[model samples]
Target: MIGRLNHVAIAVPDLDAACAQYASALGATVGAPQDEPDHGVTVVFIDLPNTKIEFLYPLGDDSPIKGFLEKNPSGGIHHICYEVDDIVAAREKLLAEGARVLGNGEPKIGAHGKPVLFLHPKDFNGCLIELEQV
Candidate 1:
């Protein structure tokens, strides 16, 4: 049902600063940053061997990450995305198995330029899960 670790989203206060830090510390080149207004955040991706890391920051106070930051101040891992070959089938199978979906049955453009959907954490052992078709 799962493919690979697509990315690990880390909520940060400053996307640029976080990207720079990752670049300097891990010698990772940051990809172009993208603003996902629909999701209320912006992101910069750093590709790795088998997975990638996404630096996300709130676009405004209404952003979900903003609330996360309010709770932890210094933000942290927001969620983990797994690449899947068939999102619709996977989603349907998950739903049939009693997984709660965070959104309606629609795939939205994700930070990685792929169609994505979020599965409720309640269905994933308290770990927020993301499914991306890439």
Candidate 2:
């Protein structure tokens, strides 16, 4: 049902600072910031050999990341994304298994320009799971 790890997302209060820290600390190529208005986050991806690390900042006052930041203050991991061959089929299988899907249970276009769906954190042992069709 899940393929390779896609990316790990970290919610940050300051996107620039996070990106700079990653760039200097990891010495990795950090991509430009991309504003995803639909998701209400401004993100930047730090490329790694095996996977990517996404730094997300709230885009608006109502952004979900804003709430996450409020809770964690310093910010922390928000979600982990996994690649799926077919998101619809994956969603069906997950639903049949009684897993709770977040939002409308429909796939939305994600920052990577792929269909993505988020699963409830409690269902995955307190870790938010994002399924991205690759």
Candidate 3:
């Protein structure tokens, strides 16, 4: 099962501009950009009182974000991440309940360095869902 809302991920064509918009215009605290080669993204986290906003940009030609940006040049919300107490157990429960897990049904190291798995968007009302073990 899902726990607290971890973070909302947004794909942005320009990382610096997006960070500036959040930092200067919105007066938010933006964390340093981190390159996640495995995920093919360069990310910047906007810290908030309750939850975080993740700004992601494509890292390579084959980056998924690149495809997303191509579809929507302005960029948009890519996914929402929710915390889970146990990823393996959660995966099992989801599978048993007829939910489709993305990527071979295995957890990968996320941006937070935690085990993470992505679920099919169609299974979650057209919004991509990411489950991260906390």
Candidate 4:
């Protein structure tokens, strides 16, 4: 149902500041910030050898990340993404297993330009799970 870990998303209060910290301190390669209007976020990805780390912040008043940051001022890991061969099939299996899918239970194109779906955090041991079709 799940494959390799794709990337870990971190919600931050300041997107540029967070990217600067990673670029300066860790000397990591940080990609350009891309605004996702549909998702209501401005994000930047830090590329790594094995996986990427996404740093994102709210782009609008009703952004989900905004609420997350309100609850956690310092920001934190928002979700962990895992690769799936077939997102629709994986979603069906998960639903059959009593797992709750977030959003409209439909796969939306994610930051990586792949179909992705988010699962309820409570259903996955308090950790939000993102399934990205690989």
TM-score of each predicted structure versus truth: 0.86, 0.95, 0.97, 0.94
Ten residues in a row with the worst lDDT in model 3?
A: 59-68
Q: Using TM-score, rank the candidates from best to worst.
A: 3, 2, 4, 1
- Badly placed stretches (over 4 Å) of model 2 are none
Task: Pick out the ten consecutive residues of candidate 1 with the lowest summed lDDT.
Answer: 104-113
Q: Compose the digit string of candidate 4's lDDT tens values, residues 1-134.
A: 68899899999988878988999999999999999988889989899999999998899887889888989999999999999999999999999999999989989998768899999999999999999998
Candidate 3 residues 25-130, lDDT tens each? 9999999999999888999999899999999999977888998999999999999999999999999999998999998898989878999999999999999999
Taking the tens digit of each residue's C-alpha lDDT, what string does model 1 give over 1-134? 78888889898877777888888987997888888887788878888887888888888568878888788677788899998998889888987998887878788887656889999987788889999997
**Most accurate candidate by lDDT:** 3
Per-model CA lDDT versus the true structure: 0.84, 0.92, 0.94, 0.92
Report the Cα RMSD per candidate: 1.8, 1.0, 0.8, 1.1
Q: Which stretches of candidate 3 lie over 4 Å from their true place?
A: none
lDDT of 4: 0.92
What C-alpha root-mean-square deviation, in Å, does candidate 2 show against the real structure?
A: 1.0
Regarding lDDT, does 2 or 3 come out ahead?
3
Q: For model 3, which pairs clash?
A: none
